[model samples]
Target: MTVEYRPIVPKIKRFKILVIKIVFIVLGRAFQSASQHDEEIKREISSWRDGFTLIMKVMPDGPYMGLEKKNNMLEFKGSKLKQADLEIYFRNVESAFMIMTPQMGSHQAFAEKRMSIKGDLGIATAFTRALVIVMSVLYPEFIVKRLVKRVPPLTIKRAGLRVWLYTLGIVLGR
Candidate 1:
């Protein structure tokens, strides 16, 4: 008797896709809410096209998630749009989870070769900066400091306001 080969690729792919979608949806909500309340973040993203899209994938050719900025509003969805201005690829699911979950800072991940970027480098850099700012809004100062290379100066009042707004956005499903 001979054993038949079984393929686990499809199940693995589906799992990766689900993770990517969940990560991006949370990020999209945070970014959109931050932009609405933070002048600096709004200014940073204003230069981007109204319908600019960014895709992040776990591998060069793998399940991906997309973030679309339209009419100054940001939305995240799974696997839409044929092209994007920027595409960030993490070496694997573990690498993606590390950065997305704040287990490692994005800058560290880039330096360690866990992540790679395609498309315009400038656009990617700007987007990364915006993400850092959004993180500051979403997390406490101590946590944000650990996640970013250099935390921007923030007054206690401003930080408190940001945290409140971010929480409100999440509560209201903004």
Candidate 2:
């Protein structure tokens, strides 16, 4: 009797990429909404110079999404530009998927080396704060508390902002 063996091959799932793309769309849209309605986000972005761009993508051939501050507002860039002032890369689709699912926060992802940042450290810190603020408002209090170190109190404004996000901001892809 003769036995033949083949090699085990790893495949990147299309569904995973699709899900990530969808999540990026929603998250990008949410950022735009947050800039408009959330004071914290406005404060953070307002400090950035006009035309500043931030890009987030999976490494080694993956989908990308971006945002740019233009005219004191953030607009989705749809990954058209090849470069950005700040670039965040998830090591792989799996890593991107994990973060997109928000299994852990971006801070943990960076610590684990699953994510890398290319840009000014100070701006990155400010962006982190803005991200925390966005996550606090975008997710429910229970979920937000579990995901991040500090969950800002769910004030009436944040609650209303959340409602607007779900209803118009995210839904309409603003």
Candidate 3:
């Protein structure tokens, strides 16, 4: 009996995982920056107790990103994979990518059965709002229009925030 040769699936998955990992790295930094700078994000997190942790990870496998609230600002826990107060689990890499990119939003992903949550719904809601605020600042107007239900007004301040994200947030992770 000849065994089936299935080399492609593993390679493809590894590639998808890598792409997702990079996206998560940038995402962690963006979240941290927004928490520190955006007034909306600050207000959103104000209710959360210090040390609040959230993790976003793909299901049935490895690779995860953790974010925690400390000193009233969000911090990226790059090497962390611990139990969080709110954990957002993606059924697969495609689902995570779609949600992470402007291709789709978190609400759509959940409704489509591509995502799941384990923890407090209120925290998740607040986190989603914070993420929406961050994404709007990071992406351009065209992409943001599609990523969010309502596009934030194009202003000099928003443009500057995007600039800071590129030069400092994504780069130095500040």
Candidate 4:
């Protein structure tokens, strides 16, 4: 008798999951290490706060305010910020992230509800916009690219489709 080798999708999935787990662990550790050196980030951000006011709906447990400057001063709530010479807002991190992400155009999610803002809308918009810009610069794109490159051969399209299907299934209780 002889045995035949077989390719199994389940095995492939398990392997993919393992790979993703390893990637996340490595990235998480890297972040933890980098955070220990955050004084540099603090200095960089402090230099940017030359002329700006920022209000944040800080998580009860989070550091309450962030003032940063790039080409101009910016105030960040969570990561939300205003960019004009003088800008302010009372916003939370969720709102900031939502406004800055591509979701701003239409898919505005949870930000408005989760955060409260009482200030100049124009300046607030500037703050969020500037925060987006500074964050883009501060976040290491190279790490992101490398992490993405490590993803299983599954393309983003496939991943997105899988997520959509999974979501649908959960919603439909299938």
Return the top candidate by TM-score.
Answer: 2
TM-score of each: 0.77, 0.91, 0.88, 0.30
Local accuracy of candidate 3 as per-residue lDDT tens digits, 1-174 = 999987674445777678788888999988887678777789999999999888998886757899999998899997475779999999988887777655887767778888889999988988888887788888877777776677656567667778889888766666
C-alpha lDDT of residue 84 in model 3? 90
lDDT of 1 by residue, 77-147 (tens): 44775567788889987788778777788899999999899888888888888888877766677888888
Could you tell me the lDDT of residue 136 within candidate 2?
Answer: 85
> TM-score-based ranking, best first?
2, 3, 1, 4
> Per-residue lDDT for 119-149 in model 4, tens only?
5665555334433322222234443233222
Error of 3 at 134 (Å): 0.8
Measured over all alpha carbons after superposition, the RMSD of each candidate to the real structure, in angstroms, is 3.4, 2.1, 2.6, 19.5
Query: Model 3, residue 23: what's the lDDT?
Result: 85
Tell me the tens digit of each residue's lDDT in model 2 across 1-174: 898899989887899999889988888888887788788878888879999999889898899999999877688877786789999899999999998887778888889999999998788888888888878877777777776888877789989988899899876645
Q: lDDT (0-100) at residue 40 of candidate 1?
A: 72
The deviation in Å at residue 166 for candidate 2 is 0.3
Candidate 3 matches the true fold with a TM-score of 0.88
C-alpha lDDT values of all predictions = 0.74, 0.85, 0.81, 0.35
* Candidate 3 runs further than 4 Å off: 1-12
Better of 1 and 3 by TM-score: 3
